[model samples]
Target: MARRQRTPRRTDDNLPSAIDRFDDAVDAAWGRVFRGHPVADRIFYLASEVGDFSVLWLLIAATQGLRSDEDADASIRFSLLILGESLLVNQGIKRLVHRPRPTPTEPRPLHVRSPMTSSFPSGHASSAMAAAHLLSKRSPRLRPAIYLLAGIVATSRVHVQVHHASDVIAGAAIGTAYARLADRCVPGALP
Candidate 1:
């Protein structure tokens, strides 16, 4: 009997093969299933826009302003917190990671313009999750719906070929942790 030698597995030098495969699989799956539906495209476009501009969070803050002075103050603090988180993720962390955006494997009209920064951590996802976390904590009654929109906004990056699933996951984690910190430091931000 002869012994067989094993060949070395392939890798991307910077990222592990497993992670690369997972990212590729997710990107391919999303492109295959979610790229061409008219209604879904529209929905995701709107969601992406909301995430980009923090439109929903701004609207929530504006509505909170109408209710009472305390609510208004909390909303302003929440907005500032999310803005800081977005800046850190977009400028600091993304430049450090320097991972390129995924190459478009499918033809889908991008709802929002492509981001100029690197794609390791999604700014939109980070901002969305941070806003969702703060807002939901304050308004427990709307938590489920708030998080759902956050999720959709994060996933929309992958759907549109701008980010990998892992990128969004990392962004979500960063956003959640940052929001928790804000909640702790600025008492009453959560409630």
Candidate 2:
């Protein structure tokens, strides 16, 4: 008897399949929109780079910490908190989800950082929003700028083709949830 050839499993699912298709559309759109601007690509590359290991957030926390002794204490706390966030997202959660990063069909538009982590959730997106939440406490007046920076950092992950748009969206949600949870559970813990 001849054996039957097995086909790949596809549920023809609604939400999951729809989401994947939408994400692909967004990724393709991003490629088309930024196709030929070397300078724009470089800027995105650098923005994504700065998000590595939450360096940008740490810097902002340190700057805020420098303002006063109280601020210094808060800065230290916030920095540690961001690091803790990194640990949770990178080590704890990423290890469980083995999602792959987006693969570019053509030569990359610009240089991009090769990260060693799951693509299900973007670490850059997580840290950026988390830091925005904590650091905004330092100067409430700069809230808009702080969140804007966070938005830029989070989206840069997608623009540079290192992460899918859903990954970024989920990561931002996780980061926001974590920040809020930290605020509620550990009162006065974050800056």
Candidate 3:
């Protein structure tokens, strides 16, 4: 029997570590750009607000309520399943990791008020990526839009200082995998 080879673990010196530096640079640049901009500040404030996973629940409800044609309804249902799976995987991993959020003492200038939760594998990033992947699979024509939204949402997590770059990357991977799995489990569920 042949054994499967596992990918090596990423170390701090690898390319993945560069994400942290990139995040710091982005934070610094945005901080300087948005300094004293009340509107921008308010937007960040609202962006960071966590509402007990209300967005996921709403997606599920919307899917259930959808009464469109088979293709449309299936797509909606697939999206909802992806959202739920993403949330479950993201939250479950976060609980296990229990990593700490960046401290205010950190040198970066954070635009939004800090979040009060463990910060490994950001839920927002995970959910956004899952939706993006699922949507892109279902509607190839919308790939750009879906991925663009996912990128923005993932970047927002770092902008709000609620998640580290590593967290977002991990979340993206996990969410993408979960969505793929959900799609396999429920065929024709998403157009």
Candidate 4:
């Protein structure tokens, strides 16, 4: 009988190991910084709730679209982008990464909705950042507040112990990239 030929495994494992360590360290640091504060808990919990399915963003869009014709047009366009971003992040990307969430997907004492998606990239973080970007185009005057809200929404995941720090980080980056690309590619996707 002839012996079977063996093939060497591809891709380096050290990089992924190092990344996992970094993510763990950061998540631990985050927990230490803000996990014990009552006020912070309230704020982050509120932000997390608002970030669900990008409801806050949609509300903002509706408000913006209520004014002039131009504002209304821009608002509609951006709102669609926000919804689309959620679908992509929550549905599409979640399937690919398939990373388990920091906590179980079951309802916890926090009373927040437990998401079933994998936790590699946080949909809340992604939608928040993407809406912040697209909505900024609609209302430049509110840019700072918009981005600030986005940051809060993204960090709230970690604060609530629902997602890892690295998941939020990657999600923010992906949201920004997706928004930029969609803004450029979509026909008449103007502010």
Compute the lDDT of residue 32 as modeled in candidate 1. 68
RMSD of each: 6.0, 6.2, 6.3, 4.0
Task: Assess candidate 3 and give its lDDT.
Answer: 0.64
Best by lDDT: 2
The TM-score of candidate 2 is 0.88
Residue-wise C-alpha lDDT for candidate 4, range 69-135, written one tens digit per residue: 8878877888778778878877788988888777532333355677788988988888888888888
TM-score of each: 0.87, 0.88, 0.65, 0.87
Worst 10 residues of 4 by lDDT: 103-112
Descending-lDDT candidate ranking: 2, 4, 1, 3
Q: Which ten residues in a row have the lowest lDDT in candidate 3?
A: 49-58
Instruction: Give lDDT tens digits, candidate 2, residues 25-105.
Output: 998888788745788677777889888988888888888878889888898888778988999999988999999888865
- Clashing residue pairs in candidate 4, if any? none
Off by over 4 Å in 4: 1-10, 104-109
| Overall lDDT per candidate, in order of appearance | 0.82, 0.85, 0.64, 0.83
Q: Give the runs in model 3 whose Cα sits over 4 Å from its true position.
A: 1-67, 105-116
Q: Which regions of candidate 2 are displaced past 4 Å?
A: 1-12
| Model 1 regions lying over 4 Å from their true place | 1-15
